[model samples]
Target: MLGAVFVGINAWLPLDPLKFCISHTDCKLVILDAERAEKLEPIVDELYAEQKVIGMLVVNAQEGKGQWRRMEIFDKALQNSAAGSPPLEEESVLAEDEALIMFTSGTTGLPKGVLSTQRQFLTNVLNTQVGPRRAILRRGEDLTPPPAGPQKGALIAVPLFHVTGLTSYSMLATMAGMKIVMMRKWIPAEAVKLIRSENVTLAGGVPAMVSDLLDSSLVGHPLEGLFFGGSPASELLASQAQVAFPTARLSQAYGLTETNSVAVGIAGEDYMMRPGSTGLACPVNDMVIVADDGRVASHGEIGEIYLRGPNVMKGYYRDPDATSQVMTTDGWLKTGDVGTMDEEGFLFVKDRIKDIIIRGGENIPSLLVENALYEDARVREAAAVGVPDRRLGELVAAVVSLKAQYGGKVTESSLIESVRKSLPPFAVPVMILIQEKPFELTPSGKIIKSQLRKLAREHWELRQKNIPKSARANL
Candidate 1:
């Protein structure tokens, strides 16, 4: 029900984080599901006293019940709504008018609300359309008639709160008149069923969701395209996806909340050609890799990626200080992702600059170790981090989950040896911990490396305690 026409300025906030944003933004109205109404009732007084909210609109409410009994029920309000109102007329909206306020994932700190203007949103929608348009052009000289019946549907498995689902997929779908099969919550098995039942032609999300779908027993579904964004995906995973969904065009996009959505996309044959790259900059955007010295990095040199385009957000809502930190005076938004661009302009994301592991004054890219571990046939997932070490200042450590078939067969020492073969001595992980469970992921499908680092440190400390004094001294 979070459609483009009805909601002029859409802001999605989870219940737990709702108060902070509402209070900060001085939100005057709230519309929510009736089931969640009770949770907010207790805080309504506090919110009202602070002038954060003035009224509530409950959806899916019983005919008559609860504190919101007098409030306007959203479903009832919509029934015969157009007939009751005067003829709808399009209102003039400026390009600079705020259209959305999306909050960052806050993986490293507090979530910052990003303000996006109508221009940014519309520009992103047009830029994304170029991908499919290019695909159709590449189809080449076909006289075949368009498929009969309704437009093809796309399965939306990601949360609408994230830019990938909302700006990139949902908005684009709306503009193209594509039917959307939205999932209230992501369930791999249910997703497969929807793909077949609804005849979904396009399906995309984080790599984790795609991995789950490929691993599931669903096959021969009518999925024609699969694209993912919001995180880095290994080449190994992309290659595996090609085999699993042979008929589908696989793509990997790169973008962030500050950029509205996708600023770069690679799909179909181009994706196959550049296996690990995040593709070229979108038609409407300009991308540059800047080194630490504030100079533009040459092709093949890793540096912080910067993007400049109309698709870039206006600024952080009510946080000019935070906005100034990330956005350069020249208008480029620093993406904080360390990456390189080949001569062909294909971008390769190495890892986040903050994610690099420093071991004894030597900087080691955690992605390198993770990619090395992924090369092993037995490893299903891997994360590398630096744990405090008395002698080395910080030591490289890895946590991995093996493929079910190789669960007991694969050992921690063996995985470390595998990485050693592919990396330098200093880059090789000193400790390797096998996870019995999967790694925690953000809504965007990125692994929570902070949690993994904490787990690795705990495991290492426990191992040190278990070692004999003589053995510890030798180590």
Candidate 2:
């Protein structure tokens, strides 16, 4: 069995553990709860028959009698002479450097395999020192660290499987000797309760989580700090966060799985000064570089982001060619994000390169269109995509979910008109579809544009098929 400690901190704890084992053959599966043990019986029985059940380590079994009993069964099953080998000590497992395979949120596609070495894990942990610590030091205040206690630790309500939740809060908490208070899932009330009860100095989440907390009036007090990222937060949301939590420092960061949470963050005064910038690059890892073409775009000019430093993965597992596509020989990884850097080195993300819509010869940024739709009072959430257009090659299309309070106040034509007024005529969406429900999102709360594109294509095809005979003939 592989020597690895599985930090079980996700809502789908048992399923993740199963997937972790399946992805990495060497790692011994550690089930933290008896609830997990109960769920694993059928699967374990199947694996046992296949001679795959090697060893077991069940944590916190004493908390529940049934759980303890279930763990004992698992323990005994593995301990039987026929079961092969005994489980090794936790230190023995930690001694060797092993592959840690983590699953992506499967937001845009099937959760891709993310593999990092134990060295990479330590590198990423060390990388965290560059951002928050530097920010604190630059404050020119007293340099003493916060007193060790429950309140000093970050309050992490999100699950640990996610890169942001895991790195920003969980792993960071561990490094700081901070206690983690987790919920089965995010409940606004429960989050508030924990913040107050535990005196959680820091809380981390994406924009949607913050929006949910703000949507309800239950969060009535200021927090120590509110850290958000994984998706863009509009100025409206940023302002609301400030209004709601006057004393708390509000921040946002940008990073991807390949970087292992090499985050770029700007908060407090920086957030107020430049609401949309992703702040300066984290010093722990040199995460910022501009592509050759975009290098000369000037300050605030759009460019493809290139990342360099220890934070980048060695390469994609078992796909050297695919890995080579993103990694540079000189140690840079093309991030595929279109962004701009200010004279002061603040990074502002414009849109994703893949999501850019080329309508005729014009490059229409889908994020701008999405942001426009989001600004509409009637729109609750929106996603913009490029759909095939025989005449223009590609046309702008938007899918939007309306706010319940709007009561069908806005129509497709009205939304089109709004875009026309704000943007160039060619940039206006050629098609707009209203959705009663919000778009499906990843664990990080990023809208699944790929899914939305599929749905949009189907919707447009159906609409074309239903066109009147006269209209079709004219076309």
Candidate 3:
């Protein structure tokens, strides 16, 4: 195996975050498309001067687009450099060597780079690859190989930079000899067509995307395996999916970037039986629900979830303090979600204690949005919370109490327009509620997000009250 660590950067990142990561990771070479290169044109010289990125290989470049210094066309570079080069001497690849780095948002506004070792990466692949296959076999499906004609396909509607997209979809599909079909963007009608045309065997997306796909008239039973993640799927949606795709094995997985992709999963009939639960822990992993008093919770008791496994991350890249904060002295990672482990070991994710809003499976840090709002002089205090929506699992929305002097002068639309310039389109607040009162606070004077979340969800529900119940169900 090559001994190079690959940093997965979101292709949709704006210039500020893109530059921050390029410099933070001490990246040397970057491979991007011509359009992305054009986006970096203004800071090309600055990046080079700071030695953040010394070289670039432009993928999908036009004939005259490789004019940037130290930049080469991807195809030409591959052809000229590796045409006749001799194979290098083999080196031993250690299991503990760093393999992949992915950025994840936490309580802090900025993203932290979560590092995974080779062993951890491979373990995650095995965890995902084996779970569904065994589920299929346990259900009495024939294991005999079909005659070699067309390869089975995995339809990927998510971004490749994500842990689920890269590890679960791309790597697992490649290892299983399945054809990978990636969509540039998610369009339910197009996704349905691709499933039919490509002989897709496995396909899935977040609950919100799946909701949209199920509502679309174009959807039909396609894949043998159907999985959902990003956020918990409601009982109604899971029931809807099972009814629509009777032939497919419906699955739901639970984990974060720190766990590679999945730590617990449920599929098939078991998934439907307990649609509210995220399922049993992986056989090779250790999971326990720790109570508020620092002891293991009894069956059906809610507590903080803790996970330990070969697939767990090594640490946050170059940030031991942050890593230590999340990990116990015994090595178990403290997943801030409160959940209960039933007698059967199925995990019910009752609540997420973290202030991270997952919109369509993408983690949006509330602190990040709050920081952007604070930049405007009119914003006295702003709390960004997840607003429930039928289409997106949660949409980023803010409640702002302006400074006394600027209270009546500021408008919600103006504040949203100001943040759009800095944050990515998806990260921008979709709804900004102008409030006159301060947010509810805890005994320690910290903003009570649980209270704010309730308010946000209620606001969303109230706004949709006028729509017909049948129409609102799929909105």
Query: Model 2, range 150-204, lDDT digits (tens) per residue?
Result: 4464777655666667666677778777768887666777787777787677775
TM-score to true structure, per model? 0.71, 0.64, 0.93
Name the top lDDT candidate: 3
lDDT of 3 at 347: 93
Tell me the TM-score of model 2. 0.64
lDDT score at residue 441, model 3, on the 0-100 scale: 71
Instruction: List the candidate 3 regions with Cα displacement exceeding 4 Å.
Output: 63-66, 83-91, 142-147, 467-475
Kindly list the per-residue Cα lDDT of model 1 for residues 2-117, writing each as its tens digit: 22221222233334456676666666677776655765666777777886577678877773354463356776667757559766666667788777787663333245688888
Clashing pairs in 1: none
Q: Which ten contiguous residues of candidate 2 have the minimum total lDDT?
A: 466-475
lDDT tens per residue, model 3, 245-362? 7778898889889999888988887888899988888987899999999999999999999999999999998899999999888889999899999998889999888888888888
- Reference-based lDDT, each prediction: 0.74, 0.64, 0.82
Model 1 RMSD, rounded to 1 decimal: 12.3
Candidates by TM-score, descending order = 3, 1, 2
- Of 1 and 3, the candidate ahead on TM-score is 3
